[model samples]
Each structure stands twice: as structure tokens, then as C-alpha cells.
Target: MAGNSDPLTPRAKIAVTAGKAVAAASRAAGRGSGSVIGGRVALKLDPDLLARLAQNLDVILVSATNGKTTTTRLIAEALGAAGPVVSNALGANMPAGITSALAGGSDAKYAVIEVDEKYLAGVARDTAPKCIALLNLSRDQLDRAAETRMLAENWREGLAGSKAVVIANADDPLVVWAASSSPNVIWVAAGQMWKDDAWSCPSCGGVMQRPGDDWFCGECGFRRPTPSWALSGDHVLDPHGSAWPIHLQLPGRANKANAASSAAVVAVFGVPPQVALERMYQVQAVAGRYDVVQFMQRDLRLLLAKNPAGWLETFSLIDPPPTPVILSVNARGADGTDTSWLWDVDYTRLTGHPIFVVGDRKLDLAVRLEVANQHFQVCENVDQAVQLAPPGRIEVIANYTAFQDLRRRVGN
Candidate 1:
């Protein structure tokens, strides 16, 4: 409606009016597209209509490869502590999905949506949020996204004309470069207290030095100011040194980064650092993203490892020892049609042989594991594999679809 005008506008309007009349005439017809979770028919409506739907609402857009959902949920929770908040909790990251989530909440004071990088350019144009949280970009869904640089370029273009404040991860080289070009930017850095990886400079091809958690191009002197809000100081380690006590409900180093990013965004909204951190410590995990479940009388950690980068981050979090494990892979189109990226993962570092492999594409995973000279128990289904798993400790690593099936089977 805001763009090119069609000569059939009158006809289209008449048809829409008639359709609404007929739907009203039918008792089975309810409140329309905004009702269901994935129902996003509003996206097809005129741009003016969609624009009106989001007009004057405070919008927060969160985008990243790995931790977007967790960080988005955390920000939503922290903002909710101040006032009413709305978000797409079902992992809908596209334009239509965002429209559906916003359409459902008319009384919301703030709206936070986890937008996928691929969809950011298009969605940002329509929604035009007040704040955008640019989480670290990592290689993910290479089949669809091609490369992290491509996604970063799209984000830079999408945010070029935005009036919102941009919150970025300062430690990420790509983000640091992008934020340097933006006007209103807030850097969120994980202080020296935590060990994490930083990217090198592409211009000079030099190893970037991190003065604290803020990184700078060692050769180019390209570095932004340090973050005002940082996650630093004392850490409480788990008994086995596998996990550190974050004082937050969520676990892992990635979650800590998420917590730090969320705190920074909320701090921009006038929430004190201490208050935001206190509220974050009470936040819960978004379902399926490192969600802990009780299965077979043991703590079952279900992590969604959809790409090589995510898998690497997960591996860093768990840091498997010489203990046996269970890893599952699916090559279904929905879960990701191509499994060729399996070669990119350093599966050799995994402690011992994968005890069980289960999924529709269990054989494919088995072949990879076998090629690595690792023993595996291939099963037709997850339940059968779970039954055969050793009694001590079991870790289930699954992709999208397999993760869904595993949750249903485990009664989670």
C-alpha cells in the first residue's frame, strides 16, 4: 500500500470486504489470521495495514545465528518486569511470523522479536523497530545463508535507515565494524572474566587484540569504545569444571553472553545494570535451546545444534570427556537437507565413540561416525536408542526435527 499502486485496488478492496462479510456470516469463522501461533495472513495484507498495526509500538529486534532466542527471551523478560511485553516465543524469525506475533498483542507496551539474519532486511523495513539487538554472527545454515558475511551485509543494509538504537557484541569483529558505521550504537562486551573467542581483522589479516573484552584491530587500530555494561568479576565453577555458576537459571558460556547482551539492551531502556542482572538471574530458558529435561532418571540436556558453529559452541559448553555419548543427525529437508557440513565439525575431539545414533538419517550419521573410526549404536528411533544408552550419563545432541521427536518421546 505504501509502494507502487495497483489499478485493481478498488476491486481488491471490494473482494476483501466481501470475504470479511462471508466470514462473519459463517459461525465457524473466528477472529482471523492473528489468532494462531504461525497464522500470519496479515503479512499479505496491505503495507499500510501492517504499518498501522505496529505504529507507535516500542519494537526490539534481536538477530543472531546462535543465541538470538535466548537473548531475545531474556530481554523480553527484563522488559516485562518494567511493563507488558510481547514476543514470538515459537521461534518464528521471518516477517510473516513477526507480524503474527505483533498482531496478537494490542495492549503490549514493548514487542521483542528474534529475527533471522536472512529475513532482517525485509522485516526491518516493515516493522521499523525502536531498538535492534545485533547479536554475534556465526556460520549457520550454510545451505541457506551461504556465508556469515552475506548475512552481515544484509543486516547492515537493513539497519542503514533505522531510527532505532543498535546494540551489538563488541568482541565480534564483524559486529564491531558494522556498529562503527552506525550512528547510535551501544557495545555489549563479555569482560575478561570469561574465556571466549574473538574474530581477526579482515582488512589487515592480523590477530585482533582484546583490551579487556573489547577487541581492536591490532594493525589497523580499528576498535570501538569499551562497553559501559560488562559481565565480569567472580565466577563459581561446577564440580567437574564443566560449567561455571552463572547465578542465572540458564547454563553455559553462550548463555552468559546472552545474559550480558540482554542486560545491555535493558540498561539502554533505563533499567539499572544491577536490577537487570538480578532480573536476568531469575530468567528461564527458552524451550529447546539448551533446555534441560528429566529423562530415564538422569538430567537430559537437549541442545539444538543446527549448524557447525552452533555445534562447536555446544561442544565448548559441554566439553565432553572420555565418556560415551549419543549423537543424532537427520538429513530431512526440514531439518536441513544437506549434511555435508558434518565434515566441518571436529568430531575427532569428541571423547569416545557415540554410543547411539537415532533418526531417519541415522545411517548417514553412522557413516560419518564410522569414518571417524568411532563405534555407534544405530537405531531406527530415539526411544530404542535411549533404552540402549548406558546408565551413568547420557548426552543427546540433535538437530531440529530429531529434537522435536526426542522431546515428544521423552514426554518433555
Candidate 2:
């Protein structure tokens, strides 16, 4: 069990057992991964079940707008050097899903949990994690989540009294403001791809001054902190000026940045930078984000980019011009009910490629593409899009629900 020495209370055991059974039923019924439902049932039985399950484990809470899932996976791999690790590897990052993950990995000594940006505070309070990783915060699920500054304030208030060591991105002003109240913080210069939402200071609402790689509020003197670790091009520089080349199975500079952040977080657990990175190098994909599947006689590389910030990073990772790209979008609850976020993306970058748009929100995306003067064909689904694409490999970038649907349909 999670606590071989401490052992769970009888009530907690009953709740966990019941939750597992229901989750199994959910999966058997093809309702989806029953993490949320199962966890909800368990929490209803015991209001404090999450805390009870996480009581004895060394917890690390990872929360961000874009990279939390990938970072959580990397952290879990790095922590494996110490002992078994539990995490919401499937991207089910709510209270119920987190509870389910903990209950399932009863024997895990460490929990590296990916939390939704909105739910981080409550999860932090319950788990009392030894470390919290605060990645960049940008506009995501705008209708569902509060504005960027409001969320930052919420984060600041929530972390004000915590004793956990916070690993924060020094490049994101919003994240810096949010983690400012934490007693202990390790700043990492993980680059931010999107800067639209953070133009104003969270402290004094003054326009921020960006003088190349650094940002400061001219009105309040708020500024980016000096990072103890920094990601420079393909290398990570430690505080001592020693730079380590980051070699990873994962593609893109974003993953390299994530590895740098992971290395810093695991260092608190007594894992050296080299060792942590070595373990992280073993992770090639997270929840099928970068998986390539042979579907309909053609290779389709799956990439998940839910918001503008994510889209900006994804554009850099896709195959260069004329590779043929499939863009899928969905405005379901998980993907946010607002399709207006599409306007924020710079779709003109796909000018030289054959673009095929599909998903429940295909028309919404098509309209946006037309405005950008980018030519695209609206398709029924992934298979149809794949059938029409030019011969050879094709890349597919999708939002939340669309990606999940395609992942299930393609058996990736």
C-alpha cells in the first residue's frame, strides 16, 4: 500500500476500494477513463480522502497553462530514481483524477501530480507537497478560467502560507508574481513563447518594459528575478556557469525547457541535474502528444496544442513547409466552450503547407484561417483529412477533446 508503515484508516480503505471498482466499471463500459467518476465517488464517501491517501508520500504539484502534463511525466520519470512515483499521466488533472491516481499507486513513495491551473491551490493545500512547479500562465480556456492577472492573484494568495519549495519560470511575469509570496522559490529561465497576456504588471497595472530577454514594470519596479537555472538554446546552464547539453528523445525546444525545469525540481529531492535529465531522456511522449501512428496508410504525427501559447510552441515543432498539416479543434467543455481563442493564433505560418481543418469546431477554425488568407479544406475527420493529404508523412495538431477523440480512434 502507499503507506506500508503508516497504513490507511479503515474508512479510507473502503473509499479507495469502492472508487477503484467504479473506475473499472467505467472503463469496461467504454465511458472513458473512469478517473473522474471514480474519484468523485470516493471523495463523496470521505471528504478528506485525497489528503488521507497522500498523507505519507513526498508530493510535487505541477501546475501551468501549457506544459504541466508533459512536465509531470518528466518529473515522475526523474523521481523514479528514488522510488515508485504516481501521477495523472493521462492528463486527467482534476481533484477526482488526482485522487484516483494516488489511490491507484498506493505503494508509490512520490507523487508528481499535474494540476489544472484553477485547482492548484486546493490541491496544494490538501497534499502539502514538498515542491510546487509553476510553469508559465497565459490565456487558456478564457471563458472557463479567470483572467490571467486574477488567476495570478489567486495563486499568490494560495501559496502565501505554504512552505513548499517553488520551482517557477523567471521568464513569465505572471508566474513570477504568482510565486512571489512563496517562502522558498527556485527560479528557472524557461523561455515563454507567448507574451500577449503579460504585457501589464500584476503589481501596479503598469505597462511592462521588455528590454530583450528581461521584463520590468516601470511603474512599480516589479521585474523578472535572477534565475538560478537557465535554458540557453539547446543547453541548460547551472548557477555555477556550467552548461549541460540537453539530449532528449522528445523533440522541440519546449521539451528542452521542460527538462531544465524538471532538473531543477528534482534537484530538491537530492537527484543531481545529470541524473534527473538522464531519466527524463527516456520519456519520448506524454499522453500521446508526440506519438506517430500509421493511420490510413500514412504516418500521422500527433501534437496537442490547446491555447495560443501552446500553438506558438507547436508551430516551431511541426515539420517544415509543405509537409501537409491537419489542424483539429473542439469547443467542448474540456476544450473550453469559447472558440474565439482561435483569433489569437498566427495561422499565416502555415501558408506554405497544405492545411486540412477538422473536428467539432472545424468551421470555426476555417473561418479564422480564411481571415488570415491561409487556404484550408474543411474535412469530416482525421481519416478524411489523411486520405486527401499529399503522399508521405503528415502532422496533426489538435486541441483537448479533438486530440482525445483522435487518439482513441487511431488507437495511439
Candidate 3:
């Protein structure tokens, strides 16, 4: 753990103090969030504060379209066995949030940063990280990040100039193409379950096909590279073909894949395989992603499925044990104003399951559920809906603001 005081120059100290004061005022007014306003103030006062925070630090930056926050938590927890880690694990993933977390932990030698997919290039360029973990690239924040291909292009150019060792997912065609040209790289065969985004090759604009566990473009020679670190079932495989079992308190293969990616980076510093897995197993929940809550005389397993891709992963891991599921959606600014992406999500898998539709977008979700012929009930009151569910550990899948609201309402 880092100490109380941060090492800053007189000018930097003034800026950081002013930022803290702004943050305090914002919180007192109940107008802004943690680290968001403070970091903005700090950066406004000193534009180069991020670079200053990066000085002489062993930085490990994690960026992805889907699993950046959870994966960064896995990385930080795994690294916590050695020493303190500085990271924005609370989902404040922008440059401001990154700067705020870094500024506070100024003395910590190790930092596991969660960089936004679009900001990876700029953050990596400024931080000069020792290793950069590149996860799958897909359509996200469509209003802000228009296209996935453009994001991949920016990262491709960013990785080209970076001095860091790139630890990339070999199975993602977009990731493979973006990181293939890097001078130093470690490819991990973290499975790419979502193939909608990779139907077209990024390099030669050719059609791509997935045959067996590998994918290749017909026109160009672009293909899924041979991974040095691979995940097979519940075990992570080493280069020498050794298998080690991994059991996480967190559910889903997505998390297991995340654990493998974190383990790969920890190995760069010579951490034992079992030791890394042990540290990752300690992560039970991240920002209410997979936390089981006792609320309104019912136990609920909260699954934060924000998008179609995330929903796909959650549906795959969901246990069909006759337990009811609370399906909530909200089209807030953070959850994306355009809820039309709901159509792209294949809700067919959720058919024949007990579901309670809630949230501001309940009508929209209920319509989609009915269209899919899935049995569901709409409840304006979530607590009463939970009471109607069978007495057991039920699953709750909620979107951005809905999930956070449920967390506050249930836990409080």
C-alpha cells in the first residue's frame, strides 16, 4: 500500500491540491463523482500530470472493448501479492480517472491501468508502460467511438511506436492484425467467442473464416497466430504443455480467459504459475459485475451485462437451475441513448427461462423478450418482483445505471 503523501513539485502539488478541493466540493454538493472532477481539475491545471505520474514506474496497461475493467482488476489483484498497485478499478476508465488514480498513489512502484480502447494509444504513448494487454476490439459507445475498425487502426499505429512488450489475444483477428507488427509481443489464445466484428479482415479487406479454433482470411494471409499462453477448459496451458487448474469465485469463461491474460503478464516478471492463479482467485466481484447480494429477503447474483457481447458471455455461463433472473435495462447517457443495439443481441438463448423485466427501459426489454417468445413478467417494483421469485440464488442482469442503482437500493 502507498503512504498518505504524494511526491509532487511545488507547482504540481498546488494543482493536485486544487483538484482535491474541487473534488471535495463536488462531492459535498452531490453533483459529481469520485476522481472524475478532481482528475479533470488536476489535468486542467497541469496538462502533463499523467507523464509526470509515469516517471520511473513499472506500468502494466490493460485495454479492451469488453473486459478492460474486470481484467485490470484481475491484473491488479494478481500483482497485489508482490506490492501495492495503482489502478482505476471503479470503472472511471478515461484519462481523467487514470490521472486521478495515478496522482493519489504517487509513491506506488507498480500500476495496473485500465485504459479506454480509444485512449489506449495516447495513454500508452505518454505512460511508456512495460507491458500493454490488448483484448478484443468490438463496436462500443457507437455514438462516441463510431466504428471498431477505426479504433483498431489507431491502436495499430499506437503499438507501432510503443516501447512496451505487447501481450495480445491471438484469437481476435482485429487484435492479431493490430499487434502483429509490434517489435516485441506475447500472443495468448484467449478465445474470441464473438465473431460478428471479425467477419471481415482488417488488413486486406478480405472475408475471414473460423475453421476449428483458428481463423484466416481467404484473400490475405491474415490468421490467428499461434499463442504461447493458451486456455483449455478450466486450465491454463504453458509453453511446455503443462496444465494447471484454475478455480475462480467469479463465474464465466470470459473471466477465466481474463485470468489467463493477467497470468501471462505476471509471468513476464517471473511470478510462479500457481501463485498468479491463487491471487486471481481472490477476485470475487468487480464493481458489482458478479456480486451475490442478499436483498429483500432474497439472494441475487448480479451480472452486469451492459451490451450484446457482454450478455452473450453471461448467458453462456448462466446456470439453468430454475432460478428466476431479473433483466433490467436503462437507456441513460452512460448506458448509451440508443437502445436499438438490443436487436443485435441474440435473446433466443434466454428462451424458456424465468425473467422479470425492470428499469426505465422495461417496455423495450419486455417487447424484445416477447418477440423472442421468452416468458417474462414486467414489475415496476423490483423488490416485490424478487419476492415473487423462487427461494434460492437468483441471477440479476442489469445495464449501466440500472446496475449501480440496484446496488445502492439493494445493499443500502
Candidate 4:
């Protein structure tokens, strides 16, 4: 993939320089990575900064309710086999963070961006991506983010005439409907475990009929498109019918699904499935999601699950049975101020585990666990929770902010 070899314009060069300085200052101040703040500053100085920065790079924008961060990382790893890849590897998916990331690697051959579900349209328009990966659509941060179907509709309109090759999950009707408008789409049967958000058709608002692996709207006849790529157990089946076994350091069927999609996206640039999968296998963690941290005489495997759909998939990632599972929740703005989404998640699956609840909204989680008839202990914090548990490697499943808090506490 050839890119413009010319240097950035004088204004663009100045903006990038200023943004990098701000990021460095923020890092020095210990106020968190200045990716977002730095990008915001750069954008304010030049509104077209993203476009100018992205002009020379073949951008791949990844948007989804979940898995976007990990998927973006995987795509970057796979693309790295070809040449240098610039990415927002910190899970900063907004425009500012994306801009800040792009500004750093002007000579990088590719840009793998994780776009916030709400901001995909704007970012896509600005980046003019060579490929767009629509992973899945589910209910997440409903108080601050657009509803699942509404966001899908936005994606549909935003990507209507885009020349980017859209790599989409065919199992998710919401994703299929959204990607349908794209002129070029590579559908992958990346399994969707959570089907709650897509019970109705986004096209006709009719009840969806999911018959085994296939789904169709009886009223309007909107159906699942045949996938060019699919996952059969732990193996990825490319359009050529060759199966590549997916062996990852990252756990769960969800990750395998993510790998399948990532392979497809990188294939656009002629990276073979086997080559891509080999590169992706080295990624053991993404921004500390599945990081194994030594905390409080216990090895804590940090698991992040934001909403019901994400929680469902995360449950599979945890070690099964009498192994203690620490449940944490938070109502911070980043974690969605409304705790009502807690009710939507089925906490009953943790029945066999010694469950402990912690975080700012632990009481809400306690109530939900009670209603689900799953016994749990209410702890003041993760430290107390871990101390209470007869632990070795404790599975700590937390929402966005809670996960970050625990990750920071553990110095991971």
C-alpha cells in the first residue's frame, strides 16, 4: 500500500509538534496519558488536522460496543507484518486520541484506530479509511452513548457511499444492517453470543427469526448475508475454505472471533490469514484488560466488561468453578452514570464461584446478585474482597472505571 512520501504542510507540522509536546508534558505531570488532551489541543489549532495526518496513511477504523480495543490491537499487530503501523493502543477511541496517535507516526504505513461507537461517523469521514471494521453493536453506556440500533442507523448512513472495504460480523443483525450500505463489504461469521439487543429488525422493526446460525426478518425478508470468512470452533475459515487454527495468548471464544475479523481486515492489504494470526498470537493483553497482576498475596486476572453483552462474553473468560470471582462496578461518567444497565446483566452465571462485590456501585451489583439468587460478599474495596477470598488466581470482572481503578491499584 503506497502512501504520500511528501512532508506534512507547515501548519500541520506545527500542530503535530505542539500536540506531542502536550502529551509529553501530561506524561511528566502524571495526570494520565495526554492522548485525548493533546489531540484536543491540536484539533483546536487546526480543524482539519485528522484529515491532514491521515492523508498519507491507510487507516482502518474499528467500531463496536465491545472488543474494538482488542480488535484494533490485533489488526495493528497483523498489519505490522507489512510495515510500521500507527494506532491508538491506549483504548483512547475518540477523535482527539486518534488525532494524537496519527500525529506521532507521520511516516507509518498504516493506522489502526479504535473509534468510539458514537463518534465513528465523524472519524470515518475525516480519516477516509482504506478499511472499516464494524465488529458488533450492543447496549453500552446508554446514558451517554447512542442506543444500539440508533448507532447502527448512523453507521449505515455514514458508510453509505464509502469506498472503504467494510469487514463486518454477519452473526450480528445490527452490524449486518449497518454494513449493508457500504459498497464493499467482507462479511465474517464472527459469532455473537449476546442476542438481546438485536431481537427486532433494524430495517423493518419486525421480530427477528434466528434459526440456528441464520437469522431473518419474517416481515421484510431482511436476512443474514453469506459470510466470506467464518469461525469453526477455534479455527478461522477463509473464503478459500482453508482453515487456520487460532491459537492466542488471550482467552475466550470472543477473542477467537476478534481474531477472525482481524485476519479478514489485514487480508485487504494482502496479508494472509496464517501470517496475520501468527503476528496476533503475540498480543497477550490489550491496555491491561486481561492482565495478570500480583495484588494482595493473590494473582488477580483483571477482566473488563462494560455492559450486558460484554459481561456475557467476559464470563466465559473467567476460570470456572470454586475459583473466586470478584465483581466490581462503578457509576463514574466514563462508566455510565446510570446503574440501571446492571439489571440487564445476568449475574446468575457466577453461581459456582465464591463471588465478592466491590467498587462505587457494589451495592447495586449486590442487589442484582441477590435477585439472581447468587450468594456474594459486599466488600469496601478490591483489597478487602481479595483478602476475604481463599484465593490463588482470583478472576476480577469489572466495568470500565472499576477495571481501571484495580489496574492502577495493582500498578499494571
Q: What are the per-residue Cα lDDT tens digits for candidate 1 across 43-149?
A: 34444433554565678889877778788888887787677888987776776557656655657878888888788767677677778888777665556664665
Misplaced by over 4 Å in model 1 are 1-39, 191-225, 233-246, 295-299, 319-324, 371-373
Q: List the residue pairs that clash in candidate 3.
A: none
Q: lDDT for every model?
A: 0.66, 0.92, 0.84, 0.92
User: Which ten residues in a row are the worst by lDDT in model 3?
Assistant: 1-10
Candidate 4's error at 223, in angstroms?
0.2
Give the runs in model 3 whose Cα sits over 4 Å from its true position.
Answer: 1-7, 29-33
- Report lDDT (Cα) of residue 103, candidate 4: 86
- Candidate 1 accuracy as TM-score: 0.80
What is the lDDT, from 0 to 100, of the residue 167 in candidate 3?
Answer: 91
Model 3 per-residue lDDT tens digits across residues 1-412: 1344343667777778888888788888987465888999998988888877777578899988889889999888888777777888887888888888887785576889999887888898878899999988876555666488888888898889577889999999889888976899999988988888989999988899889888999897888888999989999997777887888998989998998898898887677668889988888889878888888777888888777788888899887847788888998888887787787789888775778889999999888888988888899867867977876788898888899888888883
Error of 3 at 176 (Å): 1.1
Please identify which of the two predictions, 1 or 4, would achieve the higher lDDT against the true structure. Answer: 4
**What's the C-alpha lDDT at position 179 in model 4?**
95
Task: List, residue by residue over 162-192, the lDDT tens digit for candidate 4.
Answer: 9999999999999999999999999999999
TM-score of each prediction: 0.80, 0.98, 0.95, 0.98
Order of quality (TM-score)? 4, 2, 3, 1
